[model samples]
Target: MGSWERPYWESTVDSGVPRAAQRSGAYRRYLPDAIDGMALAIDGDLSRDVAVVERKLRALNGPGAEGLAGIARFLLRSEAIASSRIEGIAPSAQQVAIAELGQSESVRGVSEQAQLVANNMTIVREATTELVVADKVAVEDIVELHRSLLPNEPRHHELRTVQNWIGTSDWSPIDAAYVPPDPDRVVGLMTDLLRYLNGAAHAPLVQAAIVHAQFETIHPFTDGNGRVGRALIHTVLARRGLTEQAVLPVSLVLATLTDEYITGLDSYRHDAAPGSPPAGMAINAWLRTFVTAAEIAVEQSQQLVSAIEELRERWTERLAEYRMAAGLRAAPRADSAVARVLVHLPEAPVLTATTLARILDVSYPAASAALDELRQAGVLATKSIERGTTAFIAREVLDLVTWSERALASTRFDTRRAEPVRPVPARPQR
Candidate 1:
């Protein structure tokens, strides 16, 4: 009646540690049904934490969070960037945004690091959409997600065929921070994890915490485990119908607190050990960290939404000023460069005249004119990344995106810790 444990032969051909035990505690395969001494019971305090996180998330994607979908897209970019950082791949959010917009091939394949995050972004978004309709997560669903992220890898859509360890600097697990169940046991362990996903054994947040930590423990895939494991967090939210459209940047929050995040996973593995501690006490500690991280993620995301909305308001004022200055105060059509660029700023924080024209459905001349106006109004800044190509930077949006990630990852998790949007520069005195 022990929490599920798997056997790994020590001193085997691929064994990192030189021992002779046919089975070891490090290789225990966890199951969804139950643990020997750890039944997932929600104590009163834990219940409160779960309720708060669920309620916050429910409100974020619910009716209360209006006009946020546009800015929320930016949060998705932030998520991809921050999640990528967790795996030690740091790419500017602007580059990732350009890739996501599908307008620039220059950023594509720039480096393996950037590409991995872009792939994960695609996988997470696609998987979220899939889980919405399926109402449950399946193994095939996971495979497709993995394949999408690491299409060229040997085990792209399949489980790892060899053992994988975390925090190992070399080809040995002896000094590794954590080692998962053996490769042969990945399928069965994943099955049990999915069973828990498809069950009502716990609240959505708690179940998600267990599913994520357990997925990390199983370490099913050889590559992209961290990204996929993070994506599964959203899968749980989508399946439970908690997040209608809001993709909470939970990984961004976790990335800032690396030690706390990893420790939570370690707790998940050790606390559920047979007879180690009472089910509630150990599980409660881990769940507390999970729920708190989630709360911070949502709160910071909300602050981001507000910051974006405020930027939009400035855009509105700037547009009116431009119209009045141009003697078009009574103009019936708001089809000027100011209006067009403002609308596209949220999703496309970085753009060029050629691409801007295509996105705004306007002529090259019009897009150029709009860019000119944006530059004059301090709405967009310009940077030359390559010859004959000027990148129009949405400073407000870009600042908010990158700054929010730093803020979330640091000790400050976006709770009323606001950084005012940079104001538009006034025209020089005549």
Candidate 2:
């Protein structure tokens, strides 16, 4: 049965700590049931719904899709950014791209929030890719993932030694809306969680929902729990082979369904007997919510794929027009730098010539010429990164990224009728 224990909090009166936090008292800490062997009773209708969404996700990652790999990269970034935004680390997609550009070369005009989101993007990519290939996901593996997510925050790199709570007093767990297990219980719970993750006892979507909810319940790390928990959703999908090329961006939909999302998690944390009908219903309700979010993710991501493909077609026509006006007799060879750069623009929308040369394995002059050609053709725009170092951006790609973010932010998936519940960056200026 899910249970709770009253742990006495003898608060230390640290400087600047609130006086209320100094009062010593007993607070309840939840101890969630180990789920490695838990039986989940899902109805047939819900089972079929989950299976249909799984098929859609697979089709989205289907082999031979043009620009599949690049689109996957873009979606991965979108997922990371949305996940970070859910934690209130909102940053413009373009700013995040520039922050990513900063990783390759000197850059300016990027914020710390953008860089943090960029770090999230990197860790999400690494987690989904690396965790899928590991023989077994160890406790250390999950710890390392947290470490990577918070490279600058040393205290958060390890499992939290002190108590942490969500909402209410920042100084103490007093009156907090939710409190996870005691610090001493963390490793054992995490071990059980990892064991479940390494197995395939449930359907992909069901398993992902349980894994994510369990991780959030454990709240293992003092910080970054939300981002790490969301990354695990993608990891579970990839490991189960449901997603091989594209991330579902489920967090994007979840962010818009914040109230339902929290309520679902709350239901999952019920004190009912783990084997009782109430327990089954509790989890099943959460599964329905998660499955719905997954369905929305697939539908919206499909639209993004279509939008990107359409943009690619427009670039091709514009390139043709530019070449015709220049009086060139034939198109640039398929393997030429211009062609290669165009192929990769979806993935790497912002680039420096130096970065492009390294990415495409071409001569510096060749990459520079390709950038010049694409810029002249109106397929790319130039932005000053730093003195003497200009970064080229595919504004349309960045705008699409912004639009996707905004679209996901809205409850309706259309910004025209609904404003975002969270702050979404305005569309980039042309």
Candidate 3:
């Protein structure tokens, strides 16, 4: 079957047009068991639910009111991943450019794709935040998110004024309901899903799973359905207060199991028979997969966080031993700010001195001094000029950030590495 064909669903349309039909796929036969288990789990007492899942998350927290501390920790780390590429970082650099859209704080190199990523992140962040408060996440909200994600790209975010479909030839199945829905159908399905989502009784995980599956099946919006759909998962969980902080990095999990992730969706699209169950069973299986992934991601993230904190502490001890300058003590602080700026350097390696001043919260000269120090330290290099002004680039810092990011990416899947701990010697007091 082609990319358009749902795995288990038989194609009814000979014309190469996608159309939905009653699912007779193998997935339909087994969905009931999955759904029943999920419903039972969700309907159980809040305490039990917390015991099963929240306990794993709780271990990541230090103390009181650290609500959903797992998710919060995940969000910060994920943001690091999202913002890394703008600084000319690797791997995520491409994904970041495709996802985030905003100005960098430091003067650094950035590419067109990095700009795209910065824009995407801004849109995702705003939309997800709004979703946390709103009862129903509307198509309009999604449109707004898309607009934010691709501000300059008109075709990407614009609503479909004309009909669109996924299929190839004269045999397009108009009667089959399994194919991706048309634009009008897409809007209707999303509206219905949102209504279901806003209801009081629906379990958050179940609701999230349903919405994600339906959105994928609907394939609404010309582009970014996948990213937006994924974003919706976080929105629902956050809105329900399942995560005290943005601890769940679902994308990292999904990105890791790329093939199985797609196959799960494919199974749903094909096996969901009309007038049967709500595809809840197939969807629940997907959720189970997701839950497992989430558990693994949380564990990995906790390790990473511990590693970073430990690394920082070791560096602190080392700095004391080496008698490093106070300025060097501030270098780690620059990691976040400098990393943000460098991720944007793929498109253009220029930021106005005034902008740098605002970002670094220092005077132009101070910002310039920081740039000069970095340049002298071989961490950054000077790029081109605009109107007799200079722009700087962070080559080594970007490399370091990218190297660190690989650790995050490595944890995206099932592969686990022992957390690297730096060995620091005892410092002799003067």
lDDT of 3 by residue, 1-430 (tens): 1123333435444443344342234211111111211332332443244356546554454432232232233233344333332343322432232222135433234555545445555555766788788866676887786665555557767566433344432343333333454355455556666776666455565566656766766666766666667777777767766655534665666765667777777655534345443544445556666666666656655654454444334434543333345444533454544434333332223354555677657677766765555455443456553445565653322332343334435533322463222211112121
Candidate 3 local accuracy as lDDT?
0.49
Q: Roughly what TM-score does model 3 have, to 2 decimal places?
A: 0.58
Best by TM-score: 2
RMSD of every candidate to native, in Å, equals 6.4, 3.4, 10.0
Cα-lDDT of candidate 2: 0.83
Clashing pairs in 1: 5-28, 6-28, 6-29, 256-409
Q: Supply candidate 2's per-residue lDDT for 427.
A: 64
Please give me the total number of clashing residue pairs in predicted model 1. 4
Worst 10 residues of 3 by lDDT: 27-36
Per-prediction tally of clashes: 4, 0, 57
- Across 212-299, the per-residue lDDT of candidate 2 in tens digits comes to 9999999999888987888899889989988777667797689789999999998888775445447777788889999999999888
Reference-based TM-score of each model: 0.75, 0.87, 0.58
lDDT of 2 at 61: 71
lDDT, each prediction: 0.66, 0.83, 0.49
